[model samples]
Target: KAVICETPLGCFGQTICYDLRFPHLYRKLSQAGAQILVVPAAFTKKTGEAHWHVLNRARAIENGAFVVAPCAVGKVEGGGESYGYSLIINPWGEILADAGSDSGLINANIDLEEVNSARMRIPSLRHDKSFQF
Candidate 1:
């Protein structure tokens, strides 16, 4: 389903946390002309430590879209620590800035031009999707 909705800036498809596991969804969104994917997440300490950074970078690198994820930090009630590596990743799998285990705002200087260049150098997006099943 091709969907579009609104954000503070404009319209955005409101996909939840589980959707991050599906890279194809991101590809579809990017192919549909999305430049940025905003992921507002509150992942638990266990899962976020395991896959957060890699997945965030992978999706951006794959689709040439900037992935901006702001995550909740600190210990929650009932003795749980939220996984707090809030980050902004570029299309080159490079972390622009990351806030680790602290509650704060991270400002990054992002250039849209880098996305095209990173994609061109590797060209992985065009090479993905080959399947054996």
Candidate 2:
């Protein structure tokens, strides 16, 4: 992963919709020096509306990393409507941009430098380790 660190973290961490439910993976990636995560999802409106944005933000805040989720909007042929709320959240739980209730590219011009700064300010990423209790 560090080999392509200059390529931008957002471009590489794109995962399926269900992957967001797993926070440990993000934690490991963050500890390995990942600063941002990308999730491309096509969740059913019923579920997306209930949990999508909140979960996305939660993951960002918990792992102290940025999250960019680009979700499919509109109704699919065989499925119900998809909740379209693409988001770009910062480490401090700030929503840089949110794509709410519509379909289009929600562009966010974030300072990639913030990731390191945020980590330094909080310094949580540098403190992770396995523990037994």
- In the range 8-120, model 1's lDDT, one tens digit per residue, is 54334345566789888887777666656777787888999998888889888888778888888879898888898888988777899899988898978777677668778
- Model 2: CA > 4 A from native: 1-12, 131-133
| Candidate 1 accuracy as lDDT | 0.77
Candidate 2 lDDT tens digits, 29-103: 777666777778988889998899888998888777788898888989976888888899988778999888799
Q: CA lDDT of 117 in candidate 2? A: 73
RMSD per candidate (Å) reads: 2.9, 2.8
How does each model score on lDDT?
Answer: 0.77, 0.77
Clashes of each: 1, 0
lDDT of 2: 0.77
**Shift of residue 66 alpha carbon in model 2, Å:** 1.7
Candidate no. 2 TM-score: 0.84
TM-scores for candidates 1 onward, in order: 0.81, 0.84
